[model samples]
Target: MGSIATRGDSKRSGNQGMIKTHSRSRHKRAQALAEMAVMVPFLVIGMMGMLDLGRAFYYQISLTNAVREAARYGAQPYYTGLSPACNAIPPATSPGASCPVPGDQNIKDRLAQELSGTGFVVDPTKIQILPDQGTRVSNCGTSGSCQYALKVTATYQFTFITPIIGDLIGNPLTLKTSSLFRTEY
Candidate 1:
């Protein structure tokens, strides 16, 4: 009888230990779930913000490159969109010659073509060939001869993929980039 009682008592003790372990595991799982519930939103938002930032940076770089390319093209000695009599500037001696610098409309069109699928459509009016400075005498070779400096600027409105980030900061950030170059021709 004493042995039977001792055996029964040991069995009850083992069952209690198992129940405690099971309850502890359940508690741990619930804790982990709660932690995840609290952290997942933040993690998701952070990831989204990172993505938006990357997109903005990429667009900025693309815009800068595009403007730089256009500026380089514009810097070449080109016509001033004038008639044949006034076509040649100091650099261009030949009348009605093909100038390195293209017309404003031409440059805008070329830039638009270059930025196709880049989500940018450059406006000709917005592109400044050389704002506040035009047809300056070239410091390059001779004082008599003239050289041109070209500057191109473009502005883009960037919209975030995630509206939450936009709400926090601001929706549709205006991104502007410019490129400056000296005329080679």
Candidate 2:
């Protein structure tokens, strides 16, 4: 409600100067709306990027578990193995008599299959087993003297919600995990 208008004889007539009619600027309101619209996409993209990173981290963890399972199976010619897959590297038990398990490819394939069964898509071909990489030490006199490693490297494709990075980064993201441990056998 507006203040009481001053009468010719009003004592407070001097204060009337402060009162004014209400006015709204369309330009200012439009500018504010435009600014909000412009900032929203950037804010959304940032949030999506954060979400993508979290997914990547989770994938890495699951991939690690998958590799562990495969490595455990491949190690010691038995189960229950090491964290760093290298520890599980099949020892030169037979000294190159055509390994019973053949090469470490079986380990990588098993891991990929398990991961896929668990609803994870990964490239198993990227897996690298140091066990088949041959002995690290050259000219070993004894069969058990040399140490080997089993490495499982996996690459994954990540889908993004925001197109902000889609054009810039072709294809999905790549995540790799590897473990190395000594063979129990």
Per-residue CA lDDT of candidate 1, range 49-125, in tens? 99998998888888788788777666654555554533545343431234444656666666777788787565566
Q: Kindly provide the TM-score of model 2 when superposed on the true structure, using C-alpha atoms.
A: 0.56
lDDT of 2 at 54: 77
For 71-105, candidate 2 gives per-residue lDDT tens digits of 66555443223223433444454433322332476
Worst 10 residues of 2 by lDDT: 15-24
Q: Which ranges of candidate 1 are over 4 A from the true structure?
A: 1-5, 77-100, 117-120, 123-125, 131-144
Q: Can you give the TM-score per candidate against the true fold? A: 0.76, 0.56
Number of the top TM-score candidate: 1
Top-lDDT candidate index: 1
Cα lDDT over the full model 1: 0.69
